[model samples]
Target chain A: DVKVTQSSRYLVKRTGEKVFLECVQDMDHENMFWYRQDPGLGLRLIYFSYDVKMKEKGDIPEGYSVSREKKERFSLILESASTNQTSMYLCASSDRGPQETQYFGPGTRLLVL
Target chain B: QQQVKQSPQSLIVQKGGISIINCAYENTAFDYFPWYQQFPGKGPALLIAIRPDVSEKKEGRFTISFNKSAKQFSLHIMDSQPGDSATYFCAASYYGQNFVFGPGTRLSVLP
Candidate 1:
């Protein structure tokens, strides 16, 4: 079975602190994504990587950055954590195809104090 | 702006009843539509999906009804049970730039 594992399930950070959320996939999918889920906002993409060392900005990419140095790992970074960044972050991976389904990891709920 | 919009932030249905959730999209280039089911403390899973070429697709009790002309699609859960209670999201993608998801509907199946 394909599995996407997140490094942390819950995290708490102070304002202005830098944070890292890691995601690793075992299926060797070429495409990986980062999204933040709010109460009524659904899942909005923050960033996505099509290949190793390649990244693209999603709809909401401000205050965030991504790293895809390896094929199996993708990481989301919060430059300066704020209260507004407190949300459930989900990571996903998929094959490099237009009509492929993405497999998501158990999300990380981050709270910024 | 939200490319896809979903209605009824929450829904309540009794066991053996039908549960329906609707979604509308703004992009015409989007050709692939998928519905995801998410449980508490878990990732969203693909429940059912449909393509623009088809009007409807059914996988057992879960069905996706698509209206190509109206740019609307819906998920119908027949004979809903308690185990079916969860959040559902509708998503669309065009040439796979990225898959955009709906706000999601929280469904509660009563005993």
Candidate 2:
């Protein structure tokens, strides 16, 4: 089974504070992704990492960044939390291929004040 | 811009009923289409997928129907039980790259 784990189930932060969300996958997939889910907007990809030290911006990458220093772990960083950035963050992993299947983590609900 | 559109923001079905959800994509370049199921308080999971080469694909109770000419696809759940109730999202991609996701459809199955 493919297991993806996020560091937090819930988080609360005030404006201007920096926040970090971590994710780990045991399957050793080559591709990792970060997405945020909002009502009516669905899920929007924030960033993607196909290999360590490499990253690509997704549709909604503004105000967010990602780091992949290891194969199994990916981290999403918020430079400064804002109310508009509050949403459920998700992490997903997939094997390296054109027919890859994404396995998602439970998600972290973040609240910004 | 690539986009996927889905209809019927919410649905209510009785037990042992069939649930159908529709999606349409704008980019004809999209080759892979997948449906994802998300439960409350949980992340989305891959339910079923279909490539443009096949008109239909089935796995047990879940099925995907594709129409290349119309740029559309759909998911049908047979004998939907309460456990099948969740938010479903349809996504399209080109060889699994540059995925574009639809809003979502929330399904409720009553006992």
lDDT digits (tens) for residues A1-113 of candidate 1:
77999999999999999999999999989999999988767788899999999999998999999999999999999999999999999999988665677889999999999
List residue ranges in candidate 2 displaced over 4 A. none
TM-score of 2: 0.93
Chain A TM-score across all models, in listed order = 0.98, 0.98
- As a whole number from 0 to 100, the lDDT of residue A23 in candidate 2 is 98
In terms of lDDT, the poorest run of 10 residues in model 2 chain A is A94-103
Clashing pairs in 2: none
What does candidate 2's lDDT look like per residue over B66-99, in tens digits?
Answer: 9999999999999999999999999886644467
Give the lDDT of residue A70 in candidate 2. Answer: 99
Where does the lowest 10-residue lDDT sum fall in candidate 1 chain A?
A94-103
Shift of residue A40 alpha carbon in model 2, Å = 1.2
How accurate locally is residue B29 in candidate 2, as Cα lDDT from 0 to 100? 78
